[model samples]
Target: MTWILVLVAIGLLSAVLLLRTRRTRQKNEPPLDKGIFPWLGHALEFGKDAAKFLTKMKDKHGDIFTVCVAGNYVTVLLDSNCYDAVLTDTKSFDLTRYSQLLMDRIFNLHLPNHDPVSERKRVNQYFNSSNLSRLCSTMRNNLQFLIASADTQNPTEWKKDTLFDFCYSLLFKAGYQTMFSTENDNTAKFTDVYEEFRRFDKILPKLARRAAARDELKFASSARKRLWELLSPNCFLTGSVTQSWMQTYLQHLKEQGLDTETQRRAMLLQLWVTQGNAGPAAFWLLGFLLTHPEALKAVKAELCSLQHLPLDKTEDTPVLNSVLKETLRLRAAALITRDVMQDKTIKLSNGQEFVLRKGDRLCIFPFLSPQMDPQIHHEPEKFKFDRFLNSDETMFCKEGLQMKYGTMPWGAGSNLCPGRDFAVCALKQVVHMILTQFDLELCDCNASMPPVDANRYGFGMLQPDGDLKVRYKLKKHN
Candidate 1:
């Protein structure tokens, strides 16, 4: 029995060593699967320019290529043909694995058990189509308050301020209002938390955030416990409309006997999604707008036509909607990630076979693919706001659906963003406010549209690297 145990251990060690050697050999041999780098195994190459790196590889190695990640081979499919298979094909791939990693590291929760489908449904309930009016009103009130606060706090500096910062302020305020029912007027409190989160997110040498991730639970736990105390059935600030809607879900669960850990997780998830993407979206929109003057003008025109109130919006404004779509195509956030759930073979139309084994990462860099595709738009580099605006809605839909690359701003497939509607509504209101109130132009003489260093995570959904300093003059009518 002892001899057998020794043999088993030896066999496991042999397998690990063999896998490591095989991966190392694959790294040095070019064109076995193109984009294979020396020593670094495509890591260093990709680390430099994540956005266009894959596209560049595809230009050299066809559409299919493999890279060694954490000592495993990850095959990246470049075009739209396999997008459906990789992203939407649940039998083959799943986002839960990647989502779980992020949720655990960033939000300190178990995501697979969290029932993303059910959570999405619940979130859908919160942003239901019928409740569009209410949501819009909530968003508008939030927008007005954010803008007014910015104006009040920094009237003169507001013009010279970076649009990216403005985007952060807007997203933070909206998220605070939506989840907490209070505008994030506490800049110090908000900035401290946000900066801390951002600092933690950066995985740098000697700066680990594992402890900080634990602290998220600690913070949520304390907040939930305090809320329970402040409002035991009948409450003052607790009964406020904003607090009720935001906190009711958890409050109801507590009444029904939820465990402390479970309740803490639920609250954290609620807070995470509301705040995570808002700031990034704002930065991207402002960055794109700063670069593309014509696009910004069209967006402003659309906003002017649709806006009835100074702070709010009317139904869908087409031009503004198009501008938002185009901007997202140019800059969306949260890198689209998926996990290989099974030993799946991806068969290419060209008769190439690639095997994606279980536990491998399937990431789509839509930021690079969507905006740079020549077939998708005329003059891919130039910002044409109406590129997505087709005369026939059906044709537009087909054109959009057929785009294999450069089209995945919010990602594609089943897990495509559930919060897209809310994001669009919020962005439209913010852009409308900015355009209606201020005449904006790029103040940074050196910068152009889609500023460089946009791609950080080697995914296309990168926001501009720095704050977009824009010249803002009060509109003549305003």
Candidate 2:
């Protein structure tokens, strides 16, 4: 009986080891690091600070290598020159298919008709380039109404709030209104939506890795469900008439034969996608301007000259555009990923060929490459407001390199953000209004830039690690 019990224990141990086993790397493949843990692999370290961890790996393996993260082998391409090897290869690498991994494991939100790949077409149409001016007009109207007279009219008295809170809260409100406005505005309802979104946002990293604690998962689940209820079609049917981008998308979803429940879930997904990055971006842009007096002065001078230009024409305000570009270069972080749909050979521009295994993942982190590489960007740590501009006021030629993509806070390829144009308009409008319409500054003028929330490295538009105290009041002339 004792021998039988001992054999049972050994069998259990053997099964555990079998489940943890990984495949061996073949010759000519990128170097592989399985990390210290069995299944978790480099997940903990990668999550802690992806920039630091990936940088360390790049130092050891040179630009490209494979590493085991969680249970998957992810081939990371840090060479700016080699990004096209993945981004351009439609036949071998597929990002749309790769999105299913996120959907299945983390979100558990089923894509309608099981086809997010084709959903891109619908999304593109909603953000059609031809209607860009109209969308910009809608967003500008919503944004100004949110920030104007009622909140900032008291020019004599200063209002104090942390910069992050102010920026995130306002952008969420305005973006929400543009996409999902109910006829008569309800500040209380907007506040409730923003608060719940913050709750969900705080847990997204853990949730994505499937490491969220029980309570965190529960709260995130509840927050998501509540958001669906708040944005449901019945809310509009009850009397608050509207035809916003969200309404347009929902109408499209309905045409696709999705039920009301499915449409609600899709609305929640839309809310998450459309509203997440803008606020963090606005906060970082404002924070950079507040901390850098020279940049602030340059943007102010540009604003003086362009008082009559349409807010939609951000390109006309070159100084503001340059500063925003500079801020994003330093602050924005995104991970471009594709599923290895087949056993494929990727050849870098330098003629190094690596054969990727089927079932592996390919990743490109531009933030670590051209965005911060000393070769591509001098003084990469410092925010140079004119970095994207030349003395002739022509756009800087990607630091003299013949590059296809540069300063891509928005991604590339077919999946590149559809609303990217609107994003530029919205961010520029916020910065323009704040700088021109009010008296705003850091409460502690000497406060330095806060550390980035490194857990958010692969996520777009990182939030600051801590908040900066700031005060603002409406300008009397405005």
- Which residue segments of model 1 deviate by more than 4 Å? 1-17, 23-40, 153-159, 182-192, 201-237, 240-272, 309-316, 347-355, 391-406, 444-455, 458-461, 471-478
Which whole-number lDDT from 0 to 100 does residue 246 have in model 2?
A: 74
What's the lDDT for all of these models? 0.58, 0.79
Over the stretch 1-478, how does candidate 2's per-residue lDDT look in tens digits?
9999999999997786557555678999999898888866898888889999998998899878999887788999876666655676777888666666666544556664556556777678877867777778888887788887447455567899999989998889999988887675598899998998898888887777777889988998998888877878666543434367776777677777878887787777778789999999999899989999999998888887656448445567888888888888898898888889899887765668888988888989989876877666678889888887743323223435455555667766655778888888889888888888789999998998899998788878898889999998877773
| Cα deviation of 381, candidate 1, in Å | 3.3
Q: What are the TM-scores, per candidate, against the unseen true structure?
A: 0.74, 0.91
Q: Report how far residue 187 has shifted in candidate 1, in Å.
A: 6.4
Model 1 Cα lDDT, one tens digit per residue, 234-260? 321353544424565666556657676
Error of 2 at 251 (Å): 2.4
- Which candidate number maximizes TM-score? 2
**Candidate 2: clashing pairs of residues:** none
